[model samples]
Target: MKAVVYEGPNVLTYKDVADVSPKANEVKLKVRACGICGSDVHGYLGITGRRIPPVIMGHEFSGEIVELGEGVNNLKPGDRVAAYPLDFCGSCEMCAKGDVHLCLNKRAFGVLDVDGAFAEYICVPAKVCFKLKDSVSYKVGSIMEPLAVSYRAVSHAGNLTGKNVLVVGTGTIGLLALSCVKAQNPRRIFVSDLSDSRLEIAKKMGADTVINPSKENSLDVIMDNTNNKGVDAVIEAVGVSATVKQSIDSLAFGGTAVWIGISDKHIDLEMQKIVTRELNVKGTFLYGFEEFRTVVEMLNEGKLNIDPILSKEITLEELPETMAQMAAGAGDIIKVTVVNND
Candidate 1:
C-alpha cells in the first residue's frame, strides 16, 4: 500500500508501506475521500505535538468496505460508509451514558499516535462505521466529522429561534456552525473573520452580516447590528484569547456561548463579565457517536447544505504539498479533501 507518510516535521513522503488488515470486529475500507483538517496542518508544522512522526494523519473520510473481520454481520463488502473516527471503549461509564466522546479510553484517529485514513486502505471498528446513502457523494460523506463537530456546538447553544446569533470565525467549522444555526431560523446571524473571501462565503451560507474584525471592532459591529442589546447566542470557533473574549463580550445577558476551537491550549478569560452577566459558557470538543450519526442523516436527508463547504479536491499523491501550502497561509482554502481516483 502506498501512503503519504509523515517522516518528520514539515516532511511527508509518498512511499510503499505494509498493507493493513481488519482485526476482529473491524472492517477494512478502501478510502474514497478524506478531508484535511486544521489540526492536521498544525501537526504538520510541528506546532502541535499530537501528530508524531511516521503516522498517517487524516480523520474526516468516507470509503467502501472491502472486507469485514470475523464477528461482523451488520454490514457487507462494497457498502459505502463514513466513520465516526473515535474508537471508544463501548462499556465505559461515559459510553453507557451516550457520551462516547468523553469515554475514559478513547483513541481518535489522526490525533496523537493512532494512524488515520491517509492511505489507500484502513481498518476501523465496525461499530463506528455509518452506512451512507447512494445520494451522498464520498466527498460529502468525508466531511461528516467536522459537520458533526459544528452540529454539537450548535446543540450546546440551546434554541436559536428568533434570536440574534454571532459566529466568531468564518473557518470551516464556523461556517458549518452558522448553517446549523440558520436551520433553527435565527432572527439574524453575524459572522466575523479576517478574510473577506470567507466572509463572502459565509454570507451565501446564510449569515445575515459579515464582520472583518481587522477592519472594525467585532464587538462594536455586533452590538450596533443588534441594536446595543448584543446577540442572544455566540459560537466561538476561534480558540484564541481575543476571539474568546469577543464571543463572551458580544453576548446579551443570560446568553450562551459555546467554544469549539482548539488553536490555543490556554488563554485568559474575562471572569467578571461572565459572572456578572450570568452568561452560560460551554467548551465543546469532538462530537459524540450519536452526533456523528445525526450529521450523516442531516446530509442524507438534504437538510444540511455542505456543497459550499469544500474548497478544493486533490488526489492522495498531492496531499503532502497541499498541506504544506495550507501551512504557508492559504486564506482562500476552506476545506481541502483528498480523493482516491483508483
Candidate 2:
C-alpha cells in the first residue's frame, strides 16, 4: 500500500508501506476519500500532542470494505462505509454514560495509537463503522466526522430559530455550522472572518451578514447591527485565545456561545459574563457514534449540500505539498481532500 507517512514537522512522503488487515471485530476498508482536518495540520506541524511521528495521519474518511475479519457479522465485503475514528474502552464511566467522546482511555484512529486512513486502506472496529447510504458521495461520507462535530455544536448552542446568531470564523467547520444552524431559521445570521474569500463563501452558504474584522471593528459592528442587544447565540469556530475573547465580547446578554474549534492555547473565560449577564458558554467535542451516523443520513437525504466547501481535490501523492498549503492558512484553499483515483 502507498501511504502518506508523516516524518516530522513540515515533512511527509508518499511511500510504499505494508498492507493492513482487519482484526477479529474489525473490517479492512479500501479508502476512497479522506478530508484533511485541522487536527491533521496540527499533527503535521508537531503541535498536536496526540500525534506521534511515523504515523498515517487522517481521521475523516469514507471507503468500501475490501475485506472482513471474523465476528464481523453486520458488515461484509463491498459495503460502503464511514467510521467513527475513536476507539473506546467500552467499559469506562464515560462510555457507560453514552458519552464515548470523552472516554478517558480512548484511542483516536490516525492520531493517537493506531495508524490512520491517509492511505489506500484502513482497518476500523466493526462497531464504529457506519454504512454510508448509496445517495451520499464518498466526499460527503468522509466529512461525516466534522459534521458530527457541528451537530454537537448545534446541540449545545440551543435553538437558533427566530434568534440572532453569530458564527465567528469562516473555516470549513464554521461554514458547516452556518449551513446546519440555518436549518433552524435563525432570525439573522452573522459570520466574521479575516479572509474576504471565505466570508463571501459564508454569504453564499446563507449567512445574512458578513463582517471582515480587518476593515471595521467587529464588536462595534455587532453592537450596531443588533441594536446593542448582542446576538442570541454565538458559535466560536476559531479556537484561538483571541477568538475566544471575541466570541465572549460579541455575545448578547443571556446568550450562549458554543466553542467547537480545537485550540493550542489555554483560554481564560470572562467570569463576569456568567454572573452579571447570566451567559451560557460551552465546549463540545466529537459527537457520539449515533451522531456520526445521523450526519451521513442527512447528507444522503439531501438535507445538506456541501459540494462547494471542497476547495480542492488531488491525488494522494499531492498531499505532502497540500498539507504545507493548508498550514500556510487559507491561501487558495478552504478544505483540501485527498482521493484515491483508482
Candidate 3:
C-alpha cells in the first residue's frame, strides 16, 4: 500500500507502506475519497501542533467496506460510507453525556498518533461509519466532516431568522458556514476574505455582500451594508488574530460570534467590547454525534448545496504537491478532495 507520509515541516513523501487491517469491532475500508482540510494544511506547516507527524494525515474521508471485524452487525462489506473520525471511549463521562468529542480517551484520525485515510486503505471502528445514500458520490461523502463542522457552528449561532449575519473568511469551512447560515433565512449575509477569488465564490454561494479586506476595509464595508449597525451575528472561520478581532468588531451589541476555525492558537481580544456591549463569544469544537448525523442526512436529502466550495479533485499521488500549494497559499484553490482511483 502507498501513503503520503508527513516527514516534517513542509515535507510529505509518497511511498509504499505496510498495509492495515481491521481490529475486532472495526472495519477495513478501501478508501475512495479524502478531502484536504485546513487543519491538515496547518499540520503540514507545523503550525497547529495537533498533527505531530511522521504519520498519515487526513480525517475527512469516505470509502467502501472491504471487510468487517467480528461483532460488527450494523454494517457489512460493500457498504459505501463516511466515517466520524474521532475515536472516543463510549464509557467516559463526556461520552455518557453525548459529548463524544470531549471524551478523555478520544483519538482523532490523522492527528498526533493515529494514521489516517491518506492511503489506499484504512481501518475505523464500525460504530463511526455512516452509510451514504445512493445519490451521494464518494467525493460528496468525503466532505461530510467539514459540513458537520459548519453545521455545528451555525447551529450554535441560535436563530438567524430576519437578522443580518456575517461570516469572516471564505475558505472551504467559511464558504460552507455561509451555506449553513443561508439555510436559517437570515435577512442578509456578508462574507469577508483576503482573496477576491474566494469572495466571488461566496457571492455565488448566496452571500449578499462580499468584502475583500485586502482591497478595502472589511469593517467599513460591513458597517455600510448594515446601515451603520454591526451585524446581528458573526461566524468566524479564520481563527487568526486579525480575523478573530474582525469577527468581534463587526458584531452589533449583544450579537453572537461562533468561532470554528483553528488556524491560530492565541488571539488578543478587547475585553471591554465583550463586556460593555454584552457580546456572546462561543467556541464550538467538532460536532456531536447527533450533529454529524444531521449533516449526513442533510446531504443525503439534498438540503445543502456544497458544489461551489469544492475547488477540484485529485488523486492520492497528487497530495504531496497539492498540500504544499495549500500550505503556501499559492493557488486559487478552495476545497480539494483526493480521490482514490485504484
Most lDDT-accurate candidate: 1
Model 2 CA deviation exceeding 4 Å by range: 219-228, 262-274, 330-332
* Per-model TM against the reference: 0.93, 0.91, 0.91
- The positional error of residue 188 in candidate 1, measured at the CA in angstroms, is 1.0
Order of candidates by TM-score, top first? 1, 2, 3
Rank order (by lDDT, best first): 1, 3, 2
Which tens-of-lDDT digit does each residue in 1-342 have in candidate 2? 999998888899999999998889989999999999988998889876667778899999999999988888999898988888888989999999988888998888888647898999998889888887788778878888888888779879887889989899888788888888877788899999998988888888888889988898988888888899888889999898878888888888888999987765687777887679888889887688778877777777777767778888888999998888778884747778888858
Instruction: Give the Cα error of residue 202 in candidate 3, in Å.
Output: 0.5
Q: Give me candidate 2's TM-score against the actual structure.
A: 0.91
Output the lDDT of residue 6, model 2.
88
**Per-residue lDDT for 113 in model 1?**
82
Deviating ranges (above 4 Å) for candidate 1: 217-220, 265-269
Error of 3 at 3 (Å): 2.0
Clash number for every model? 0, 0, 0
Candidate 2, lDDT over the whole model: 0.86
Estimate, for each residue in 1-342, the C-alpha lDDT of model 3 and write its tens digit: 989999888999999999988899999999999999878988999887877778999999999999998889999889999999989999989999989989889999999969999999999999899999889889889988888888999988999999999999887788888988887789999998888888889988899998888889988988888888999999999899999999989999999999987877788888999999999999987778888889888888887778888789998889999999877784778889999866
After aligning candidate 1 to the native by TM-score, how far in Å is the CA of 104 from where it should be? 3.3
Q: After TM-score superposition, what is the CA distance of residue 169 in candidate 2 from its true location, in Å?
A: 0.4
Q: Model 1: clashing residue pairs? A: none
Clashing pairs in 3: none
